[model samples]
Target: MKKPRLFNLFLAVNGLLLGLLIMLPILALLLASSPVEIMKLLVDPEVLTATWITLLSSFCALPLMFLLGLPSAYGLARCRGRLRRSLEVLLELPMVMPPVVAGLALLLAFGRRGLFGELFSNLGIRVTFTLGAVVLGIVFIVTPFFVRRCTVLFDGVDKKLEEAALILGATPWQAFLYVVLPVVKRGLFAELIMAVAQSVGLFGAIVMFAGNLPGRTQTLSLAIYSSFESDPQQAFALGTLLLLISLLLLAAVHMLAPRDRRL
Candidate 1:
């Protein structure tokens, strides 16, 4: 092995420090709670319901994202022009903004007096304080994760594969499903896991848009907040539950990461 340079040594130290800083809070949260209390909270109706809502809502949004985001991500990946770049920037706008601001934007856009609100009201749909609104808030914030990941994965795929499929008379949709998706399946999983994770822990936007009504739209994070105010032990227990789910999902993603398989 070659000897490390001075700069490499410094880089190693910096990376170690960063790792410790990030891991400390997670370790602390875990250490502060007991297994029994965590299980108890998990079985509690209020906590269980919110956890279900967060997980189900996140899972529900993923299919919609796949159906819609896949085409957009693929198009953005393949395009080469200033216009495409501008559009990519625009799609990422919500990601760069504050979470509360993003929620507020959703509220105004879908709220009582905004543009689509009047139309939705005419159709007898009240989004405010509804589960649909929670899903919308999640999709708004998490779509970028899916789009960004899929776009990069699609870009890396050799365009020749698609060309060959096209040459064989496969239609565009068929080519993508069979030829393209198989290659980027791992990245898609990573994006899906991340999107679900974000939606699971989401507090600001869901609370703002969906109004934290128990058994209506109360998500895990909101439940945690409420518990924190009312019952500290239950709050930590709920938090420990969220932390475990997140950690497991991340571990699964790591295990599923593609291992140098070619398309």
Candidate 2:
């Protein structure tokens, strides 16, 4: 009895310490800037441009992520054996790869002098160090996060439900649309919010591939970095805003998650 009680106490103490470690810096950042100052920063042209670029790039990446990630996730969820393991590792490579390295890899794959460089050059399309590059970087970095979560959501769905719909004269696509999707729609919505939260905060890859060009490729995270050396206060304010957006998106994700699956 005493062992169990002591272990519970130990776990509680450690959990509290972990929570504090995570929350303290966030609280400090939130409080470091005054509301008025934050508002002023938001209205600044540079800040506004960065905010717009961040949002635009994230939104642009969403469709591509959905089109590409959903099929990959569904396939991953249904697959088994060594092939599944290999595919999972391949899919997750971006998440584990260092951001700078990922950026370099993207550059090599799509840059003017890259493998497809001549083809893109002939088409008069430039990829690197542009707004398209920003979107591409976000898609590369964020797709794995979205796909992993969605794979879990897809896995949780009952195969029987899909089978039943097919037996009821539905095509595979129809069954997936009317049956499997509805069951996981809430979870999918939650994952979308999570994806957006992850997308908006990407810094290193976006900077390396897109270049931190103000009013062009610059995002809120890059803007914060640019402001930090010259104006720490402004950076703090931007950080606070970014943190608030992330916290709100995360809260929405939690709310949308199924009760049994809530974290």
Each candidate's clash count = 0, 0
Best by lDDT: 2
**Model 1: per-residue Cα lDDT over 1-263, one tens digit each:** 99999999999999999999999988888887899888778668887789888888888888887788889999999888997889789888978888888888888999988779999999999998898988888888888877888888899899999999999999998899999999888877877787777778877888888898999899888988988998887888788888889988888777777666665
Among all windows of 10 consecutive residues in model 1, the one with the lowest summed lDDT is 254-263
> RMSD of candidate 2 to the true fold?
1.8
Error of 2 at 69 (Å): 0.6
lDDT, candidate 1, equals 0.86
Q: After superposition, how far is residue 238 of candidate 1 from its true place, in Å?
A: 1.1
Model 1 pairs in collision: none
Pairs of colliding residues, candidate 2:
none
lDDT, candidate 1, at 124: 96
Q: Estimate each model's TM-score.
A: 0.93, 0.96
